[model samples]
Target: MAFFGFKDIDKLSEVDMAIYRYIVDHDEQVPLMRVRDMAKGAHVSNSSVMRFIHKIGYNSFPEFKVSFKNENQDLMRSQQNILNIFTRDAFPHDIEKTIKLVAHLMLDADNIVFFGMGGSGAIAEYGARQAASLGFNSFAVKDPFYPLIAQLQNTSNNVIITLSVSGKTSEIVETLNNFVNSPDTILISVTGNIESPVARIGRYALTYNVPETRIHKYYDLTSQVPCVYIVDGLLMELHNQDIERQK
Candidate 1:
């Protein structure tokens, strides 16, 4: 009686689904199995099992398995929780990963500018102010189409950090691609998928890897927190850098 079967269904490819299913079915008085044993049970290769764990938001098989056994709820509750975490939706793992990347990017970038549209755009603006306090020149590019032109006209050596949840926005994609050759313009994308169009064009992509369920449906602020927290992480890391520099 593993709790929920699986959520973030789209996040899991075919192999991940199979592996997860195998884990659920074998949980009661489960055998002590190595990765190889687990993979064999799942009808997947060992490498595939490990990859599947990461893809579905687990740091490792042991960590995932531990959580899988935490609750004593029935299979239905388990299934529901999976949905709640991934789709319906409370997604801690995705959010945590996003925060981690933002902190890293903030420390790494020479200068920071943010780009997004609609709600994500609003968040980018908020991120800019937050970053600015840390002595980084931060701007939220309002019009995705004209950012490159504006960047060319400005005389600062700064990187552009674009936030796109879906990574499919054509205008942002084009804007980022337009500046591919500019040494002054280093592109860092905070996007949800490694396979997204924006990730493809950016100089460096800090992928968020949101639950597939979060991406497929409409939600008010579920996805925004991941990106915002990323900015917050960046700000915190910047503070640390300042402390180090002052020492």
Candidate 2:
């Protein structure tokens, strides 16, 4: 996947993230947006917007706009490829089955805990927030040092969804290990590697099989677009249940 200049989105501040999300949500309109326009939309100053542009690896707004325009024009989102970047087959043949299974766990659970660290950690928060918006009692945990998970021990009605690119994040693997034998604890792992330790620990696993994208020896910037895709699928699956009930 072509990175957008920065190492990753990890270092982005809340203000930067606001701009980033605004740009993403308004992607088609971005090329035409002026700096002041972005500032207004993200509720930030014009200077803040400029800082975010550079922070993401662009020299200037015009440069970022050119690249963003080209990316939108060239990249096609499909099962075989995501954003024209990942080369591997990104979805399983039984994706519908996987979606249903995840939805089922969420529907049956009293609480859903989303866990990850770093980029995946942000995704964990997104998953939790999204799920809660759908009226599920969902919680997000990104801090490995947080000790509250002990409350989940041996609980059958709790679902722990772990997001990772490599699936070997020590914090995630360690947390999963802590619940290895609890019959009531359901584990669902979303990762780029299906055979990773986190996947092996899950009762259900969804792997995107995208080639790893790493940099600086420590950052796994693997396209998490797949993780977001899986989470969206699960949300839609549960949404379908709502649709069915209205019938």
Q: lDDT of each structure?
A: 0.69, 0.83
Candidate 2 residue spans exceeding 4 A from truth: 1-82, 86-88, 153-156, 245-247
Residues 1-247, model 2: lDDT tens digits: 2333345788889999899889878888999999999999999999999998887777888888888888766643333443476443678788779889789878878889999889888989998998899888898999987884576754568889999888888877887887778777788998888879998998899888776767998777777887888888888888787677669
TM-score per prediction, in order, is 0.54, 0.64
Clashing pairs in 2: 156-184
lDDT of 2 at 167: 84
Residue 55 error, candidate 2, Å:
29
Candidate 1, residue 112: Cα displacement in angstroms equals: 1.8
Query: Which residue pairs collide in model 1, if any?
Result: 3-78, 4-78, 4-79, 84-90, 103-233
Cα RMSD for candidates in order = 16.9, 11.4
lDDT of candidate 1 over 1-247, digit per residue (tens) = 2226455677777888898778778876233567888898888898998897777667877776676666433444647644333341333346455545555556656667778888778988888888887777677876876545665556546667788888888888777776788777667777777789887886566666455454446653445666665666666766876678689
